[model samples]
Structures are given as C-alpha cells and as structure tokens.
Target: MGTSAERTGLPDTEGISALPADVPAWRVLLSYVRPHRGALLAGGVLSLATAASGLVLPLVVRELIDNLGSDGPVAELVAAMAALVLINAAIGALGSYVLHRTAESVVLEARHHLIGRLLRLRLSAVERHEPGDLMSRVTADTTLLRVVTTDSLVGGVTSVLALAATVVMMGLMDLTLLGVTLLALAVAVVVIGLVVPRIHRAARHAQESVGVMGAALERMFGAFRTVKASGAEDREGDRLRGAASEAWRASVRAGKWEAVAGNTGGLAVQAAFIAVLSVGGARVASSAIEVGTLVAFLLYVYYLMPPVNQLASAVTQYQVGAAAVARIQEAEALPIEQLGPLPRATDQPIPSPPPRLQPTGTTSAPAAVTFDRVSFRYDPELPVVHDEISFAIPPGGMTAFVGPSGAGKTTVFSLIERFYEPDTGHVLLDGIDVQAWSLTDLRAAIGYVEQDAPVLSGTLRENLVFGAPGATAEEVERALRTTRLSAMINALPDGLDTTVGHRGMKLSGGERQRVAIARALLRRPRLLLLDEATSQLDAVNEAALRDTIAEAARTTTVLVVAHRLSTVTLAHRIILMDAGQVRAIGTHRELVTNSPLYAELAATQFLATAG
Candidate 1:
C-alpha cells in the first residue's frame, strides 16, 4: 500500500509520519497559547505577586529576631507576617483557577480543529491509517495540550523568575552561604539535564503503544460475530492482552525517568539546607554574621524548594507533552478534501425538528458520464486496475457491467465518485472534467450504493432519510412502498422509528439492501450507481425491485454491476469486460451471438434460452 501522502497527492518524506521534523516542540505549544495570551498573562502576574509575598516573610522574621531584646512588644510584627501569609494564599488560589480555565479552553479549540480536519480528510488518507489510531490523536493526544499550554509554558517562566529573585535575596544576606547553596544544586542540574531527553523518547513510545492497543480493540469489535462464530475468544483475548502489556511496560519506563527527574530537585534542596546550617553556625560563632542574619538565611534556603521543584516539574511535563504534540501534528498533516464553504456553528437555539436541507441538484434530467482513456492503480507497485479503458453512458436508462471478478467493475463507480483519482486520463460528468467540478456539486448530483449495502447504526427512519435529510414524510413513505419494505416496517412495533442494530445486524441481508436503495431514492439523484444492489433479495422481491429499477431508469441513469442472469436481462445494454479492458457492448441477444465470453457465462447459468 502507498503511504498517505503518495495516495493523497501530499508532500511525502522518507518516513511514514508527515510531522515537520525541523519545527521545535515549544513553537507548536505556543500556537495553542497565542489565542489566550491575555488570560495567561494575568495568571502569571498573580503568581509572581504571590511569590513576592512569600519572599518578604523571611525578611520580616529576620527583623523580628534582631529587635527581640529592645522591642517593648513583638505583637505588631507577628500580626504583619500572618496578614502576608493570608494574602499569598488568596492570590495563589485565584491564579490557579485562571490558568486551569485557560487550559480547558485551549483543549476545546484543539479538539474542534482536529475533528474538522479528520472529517474532511481525503478517503485515501483515511484508508492509509487505522481508525482507532486516528481516534487516539483526537482524544488522548489532544488532552496533553492542557498541561503544555499552562503548567509547562506559563509555570516555567514564573518558576525561573522567582528562583532568580530568591537567589538575589540570599546573596545580600551572606555570600558564603549562597556559594554553598549553588554548589549543592549544581550536581542536580547536571543529573537532570542528562535525564530529561530520555523521558521524551519513552513517552512517545508509550503513546504509540496505546494507539496500537486501541487499534487491536477496534479490529476485534468490528468483526465481533466472526470471532464468536469461529470460537476464537481465547485467541483474540490473548492478542488484546499482549497489546495492553506493551502499553503498560512503555508507560512504566516513562514514569521511572520522570520520577528520577522530579525527586532530584527535592534531594538537592535538602543537601543545600544541611550545608547552609553547618556553615552558618560556624559564622555565628566567629562573629562573621549575627544569629538573626543566619536565621533569615536559613529561611531563604527553605523557600528555594518550591521554585526548584516547580522548574523540575515543568521540564518533566514538557517532555511528555511534546511527544503528544508531535502525534497531533502528524495527524493534522494528512490531506483533506477541498469542500467548499460551510456554515459556522453558533450558540443560538435551533428549533426542534430542524428545517429541511434544500437539494443541490437543479434539474431532473439524468447526468451523462464519460471516461476518456482512464488508466489507474491504487499504488505504484500494484498492477493497473483500469488500462486506458474508455466507456460512456448517455443521459438515461439502465446499463449493466458484466465480467469475471477483478475486471475493474467496481473501480468504475470509484472513479465516478472521485474517491481516488486516475493516474492518467479524465472522468467527465456532463462533458465537464470531474476534476474541474466542485466536489460538493459533483457528488450532490449522484447517489451511490456499494456492494455490501451497509447501513449505519440508527433508527429505520433515520437510515431512510440519511441521504436526503430534508425529505418529507410523504417522500419517505413512498420510498418504503416502492422498495416493498412498507409491510415489514408496519409489522414492527415502532414502524419507521424501530432501531437498526450496528451495521443493521437486526435486519436480514435483503432488508439492509432495500434500506440502502430507499436512502438513495430519497436523494432524487440524477445518477444512481448500484453495485450488485439486488444480489441478496429473494426471487419475489428481486422481481419486484427489477421493475422498480426499470421504472427509475426512465428518468434516472442507473448503472448496475450484475452476476445473476435475472438482473442482467433487465439492462438496456450489457458491457462485457475481461482483464482491464472493455471487450464488447450490446443488448443481451447481441452479446450472446457476438461475444464468446458472454455466451459461455449465459450457458453456465442456464440463461442462454432466456436471453
């Protein structure tokens, strides 16, 4: 398979991920914070004010100690210290709330942007990555932005500045004690610098393992019935266990490195305190500094703990968050469809039972389709599915494509829908190249039903109107009747409101096919492409739907890929195909008489006399 970039016409690098390898992690983090700078600034200021108050408390203690013998009363100084502590608490609380609120807003905006991009991704891009892996980027990876934006960025700046101010205060008290403090901290700084980079590598691996585990779970659930029927419960369970264990082991590695970096700060502070205590005692005895000054100096060492710990924590968080940011960037780099302008979301109350959407198609005339020498392959390494094949269908009536499997039958519908572009040549609608047409306008003109006839998990009524949300109640009723589904729906307790289980498992194969056809019919499309649409229906239903399809072909262009003789006989023209090219095109009698492949197929199915 081709990489997402190769398949989607995006810029490709040597590796699988499209993450801008040269962009710094900090720059990506700042982009999320730029919109909320005002709030972040206010919070940073309040935090600095809180730190200032704490720094002042140690000075007041020194004055109170120095004046103890001469003061008539020490009550005033004690009360002043108490008031400063209270003010510090209040400011710290307010600042914390502001930063947290801003962090949440950043996360909300990130999710909105990611979701919009993911939904608009080209089909080729979606196919290249697992659904579960993409989902992890939106949910797990985006959550990390909260801490990176606030605690890592804003908190980091505040911690560094407070550390600087505390160091200046200590220097004025005693240079000897400040020297001892810096020596003890230097060892920790070296150790942390060596350890921080490891955290980033470990964290990225852990997150990737988590995505893998999610993909494993999605695969099992997607084919839940097959697993159960095959009696592979223990086998599948073991696969899930293996993935979970890998994620756990990777997480433990990241946590171990984080723990080392975090505790190194506290250890360094304790060592500084012990050294300051021993050195200050000697100075006091030698009359180099007074007891009061030694006491204040000790208080400053204790105060250093908070800022030092904060800096360590900020670094550790950044290492982890940067990994997540890289994953998010990789997801955002995928190619997205160029859907035209869309309406913005708003907070205004929408009326219950919302207004219907207007159909984009202007006329009821069937659309003309032409494939001009189209040659395509899904990947460069794969063989061509269409080898300069050319075919055209006029404005109306039914056409059927018949061939052995792998003759590029389904590729025709894929080309028309522009799901994947051809390597060479043009696919035109109404004589206009599809590439030149607006995606919305081109797709809006047609309705497509795939080979599987899949239905989403929803109520029966919801599935019926999915293609045409604005379809009226009468239109829905008419579609149900035309598909011969009205009686079955009426027999159910909820009628149209009855729920269809996941993938419509509650309905039979034929019923699901009918529901799909009804959905396409409600769109009132100019072109209807059905790939083996009636393959699953019973003989009675099949005959009824053949008549329905014939009726639809009068005003709509209907294309079917058929294998059964019953359905093939209904087509106005049959195109016989083999390998990657069109071999013959004619009515049933003309094909049987002129094309040996068609005659052999008809004889094998005992349809020679019928034709």
Candidate 2:
C-alpha cells in the first residue's frame, strides 16, 4: 500500500499537467462511478447547497457593516449569524455522507471486477506477471482510487462553485478590484498548470515502485526456507531494503512537486489579496466604492483561496487516481483461459469403472489422452522442451514415464494439464482437440497431484475437500483410507479438523503427500496424473505408499512421472525420455537390456547401493 505521505503528496501541488489527449483516463474512471450516479448527483446537489450557504455569509457581513448607522435589531444580527452556521454544518454533513458512501461502493465494485478478471486469466498470463504485482493492483491501487471518488470529486465541485460565486459577488462590490484579483489568479492558474503534470509523473513512478517492492517481498517470503538454508538472510534483507528505498525516493519526489504546487497556489492567493487591498483601498478613499462593500469583497476574496487551493488539489488527486487506474486496467486487459458453458457436475457421484489394459501398438481407437507428434517450448528462442513426442494412455492402466533429471519428464505432465500449449502438433482428449475443450471441463476430468503436495492455510477437512467441494463425509473417509491417511488423521490432536498451518508445514513429508493423494482421490477422476513424491522417506512409509499406488491403479488410469528407480520398476510399461524426446519404450527389464541410457541409470543406482 502507498504510505500516508504519498497519499497526501498531490493535494499540496501548485499546477498539474493537462491530461493526455489520446485516451481519456478520467472518462474511464467515471464509468465505475456510473453505477452510483444517484449518490453522486445527491452529493453534487448537497455541495452546491453548501457553496450557496457559504455565499450567504459574505452577504450577511456586508448587510451588517452597511446598516451599522441604521436602527437594525441586535437580536436579528445574532439570529442571522446562527442560521448561517447551522446551514453550513447541515449541508457539509450531507455532502460528506453521500460522497463517502458512494466512494465505498465504487471501490467495492472495482475490486470485485478486478478479482473476477484475474481469476479467469490464463495460467500462462498469470505466470507472466508476478503474483505480488497483481496483488498490489487490487489492494494498494484501489485505495488511492478512493481519494478521487470521495474527497476530490465532492470537494472539487464545491470549491469551483464557491470560487465562481465569490468572484461574481466581488465584481458586484467593485469591478476594478475584481479585475486586479482576476489577474493575480490567472498567473496562479498558469503556474499550477505547469506543476500538475510533474506531480502526475512522480505519482505514476511511485506507484510502479510500490509494485516492484511488493514483488521483491513476495519472492523473499515465498522461498523462506530456501533462503534460511542458504544463509542468505542479510542478502535478502538488503534486496528488500533496496526495493523499499526506491519506493520511498519516488514518493519523496512526488511529494516535493506537490509541495511546490501548493505553495505556489498559496503565493498566488496572497498576491491577489495584497492587490485587492491596495486597489480597493484607493477606490474607497476616492468615494467610488463604500467602505462596507470593500470589507465584504475582501471577505469573499479570502473565501476564494480555499476553493482555488482545492481545485489545484483535485487535479493532483486525479493524477494519482489515474496512475492506479492504469495498473488496474493492465490486469483487466489480460486474455483469460476460455471456459465454455459446460454443466457443472459437482452434485453427481463419480462412478468407479474396472481397469482394463490395452496394448501400446493396438489398432484400437485412441484413449482419453493422445499426444500426437506434440512439441512444446516455453520460450520461442530456446530449444523445445518436448520435441515431436507421441504417446497414448489407454482408458485404464498404469503407464509411467521414467528419465534422468531434465529429461522432459515433468514437461509431459505440464503438457497433459494444458499449462502450456504445444508449439507443433496437437494433444487430444476423447478425439477432441485439447484446446477445443474448455479448460475447466478438461481439468475436471483429470486429477493431478504434484510432487510437493501444496496445502493451503486451513483445516485438514478443508484441504481434503478442496478438489471436490461437495464430497460427502463418507467419501472423504474412503479417500483417506484409500491413501492410508485415515490412521494418521485419527492420531492428530484435532483429527480432520486440525489446522494445516501455512502450506501444510505442520505435516510430515509422507503425510503431506498422502493428504494430497486423498484430495485428488476425492475428485475420482478417470485419469490421474501423479508426479511421484520423491522426498526421502523411511522404508515403512515407502512400502505403504507403494501399496496405496497399487490400490489406486485398480480403478483409475494412472500416469506417473517416476523419479525413483524402484517406483519405475512397478510400472506395467515405462517410457524413457531424454533431451525433449522419447528415446525408448518398454518394461523395466526390457529397457535394462535394450536401452543404454536406461541401463546406465540402473547400474549407477546399483553401484551406489553396493558401495
């Protein structure tokens, strides 16, 4: 969030730059206010009433001064003064209430629309922009917008009207003095014009700096454990401090410009006051204007200062608001993953189907998933991650992908999940192109458990039902038991209700993996993609997890990216990959005999055990 200093920086400026001629930022902002048009109109009316009431005070002063020699009642004077104060207070309160309520509603609606758009954005788009930058747009930028929506809009209108009314009243008193006042104000307006753009530029930079700082902080905190282990606390602190300092410097620059603008406006008003006094005093002495009229004119002149100052401040506020709007618009403009109108099947139970194995070379129709000569690269300038890869997972069976590190093993899972589109060829599900199916429908049919098994900050029950929101208690228990997590759940202090702590940090590695598997099982997907949990575990835990995998394979089509040789040995068939290509395909024993890379990996592990 922007600091209090940054928020107030613009109100102190002298002149602001003209808005861009090409695109109307203010028009775009006003669209959000359209929904609350009634409240805005009410506020504007109240502001006009307040300005009119304020105008009455100078008139009352003029009357009092003019009729001093007349037989005017002292009681009437007191009553008039009292009425003026009461009217001002009542109108002020009404304007305040209306402006505040409307501003809150505008902010609420903006946040809702921004969040909805963000959620719909494609995974690729989200990956392109840092999460912390996105968060700043929603949280910090919206706060800056509130200033314009409430104070700037209401105060600006009232200020302009009051200034106009005061000027006309001054003209009525004495045109010569009014002309002098106008000259001084014109100079002030020109000076303010020069300053407003500087303030806006500074404000935009300050906002950008804030987003940079947020991204830096998120990166540091996200890899907290890694930083600690690497003993890089001081280094991380320095990086964060640098980001914060940059934000501070940008804020200070913006504040400095605002201060100059505000002081310049004040100087202009003071000059106008001095000019009015000198010229109006001469006119009074010459018998051209009455002393009472001159006195009232001076009072109106003083009142004009606040409105002029407010008008300048409003321009500054607008610049800050515009900076925030730009950031928000950028997020809203991102292309989201297309989700078609597929009927939600949350209420329906997933039917368990018997597992059936089909041969790899069988002339039967393709199964649910087929990678037909697919090739993908995250960066166009870089070599492909998966090159001309063709494979098929039949409707039901256990097929595993095994390879050395950086052999495109995980890329296969990424492709299957549609995290990235293949540059060449295509991926098909049930004869339909993967891209043709809506992302939601395609993902709903497949359950994926990543290697790290991320857990959110919530109770165990919340984590279990995350994948399947409407899963029954009985189904939850069945999933837990199927993954061998029921015994551990019963042993925890709060059982299913136990808080997972941030990212499930409270659970052991094996426990976390089982919890993830249970969550996936709750979805009861036809195809399950398991990136085998490779965290080192005790022999007992390993044996139990192997048994759990075997049991799960009985019902679902299991495609696993295997890291451990022992895990790969259990596969009915293993596809060996290397350097973005599927090098060989066979059972483990056959691979050891036919493929040199497979034999080398097995031998390396064998020798390590023997030693």
Best TM-score among the predictions, by candidate number: 1
Per-residue lDDT, model 1, residue 364, is 70
lDDT of each residue in 127-153, candidate 2, tens digit only: 889888999988988788778886567
> For model 2, how many clashes?
13
Worst 10 contiguous positions by lDDT, candidate 2: 10-19
lDDT of residue 488 for candidate 1: 100
RMSD of each: 7.5, 7.6
- Assess every candidate by TM-score: 0.90, 0.88
Top candidate, metric lDDT: 1
